[model samples]
Target: MPGLTFEKLLLIAIIAVFVLGPEKLPHYAAQLARLVKSLKNMASGAKDRLRDEMGPEFNDVDWQKLDPRQYDPRRIIREALLDDEGAAAPVAVKPPTRSRPVESAAQKRLGLAEAGAAAPFDSEAT
Candidate 1:
């Protein structure tokens, strides 16, 4: 998730100058500029299409809430496990115990917890 800072961009530009040489640098730079402009146009076109199709409601829409970056598996599972009445009672998750390993629905389906099931082997893997 690290972003390209000014220093990082400068370093890359310096490296590209040596690698590409001065002769082809302008040509590649123009191509890169064109690519960026085309990407912008495409994005704008999509947004315009969506706005036209959705009408006034499009402007009122909460874009941040629709972002995929906010998705978290643990948060989703925790929310799903919450009680209907919103009580403080703990969620009952039956994980494999130390004394006796229990086969969960997922484990059973994956054949990982099946009795007498041998580990998968490939002769050529080694």
Candidate 2:
């Protein structure tokens, strides 16, 4: 049913008539119809059994809300990380501040300054 439109069904029927021939086609077609009907009945019977086992809870359940297809990974993670009231708490951001560079003795010996500018070099030190 998903991919089979009326035109596609007609084309398949035409091909089947040639391949199976008119006499055997009817028999196969009837078998196919029975198979589809049985499958539908099986699915409905399963639902009915589940409903009977669950009682009133089955009817009360929100099927759409419980559907796996409706879930989003990002949204689920976000909701889990949210506060108790369901609203997302505002995040406090610290303002960017200029931090003083820590210059080690080795860096100073190498003539590297705090601001990354090269210190005055003595030719003899090399």
Give all candidates' CA lDDT scores: 0.88, 0.87
- lDDT for residue 59 in candidate 1, whole number 0-100: 91
Residue 104 error, candidate 1, Å: 8.4
lDDT of 2 by residue, 46-97 (tens): 9999999999999999889989989999998877777457665678999666
Using all chains and alpha carbons, the TM-scores for the candidates as numbered come to 0.69, 0.55
Q: Which stretches of candidate 2 lie over 4 Å from their true place?
A: 78-126
- In terms of lDDT, the poorest run of 10 residues in model 2 is 80-89
Residue range 1-126, candidate 1, lDDT tens digits? 599999999999999999999999999999999999999999999999999999999999998999999999999887777745666776798965586556678667777796656667899999
Q: List the residue pairs that clash in candidate 1.
A: none
Give all candidate RMSDs, comma-separated: 4.4, 13.9
* Best model per TM-score: 1
Which candidate has the highest lDDT of all?
1
TM-score of 1: 0.69
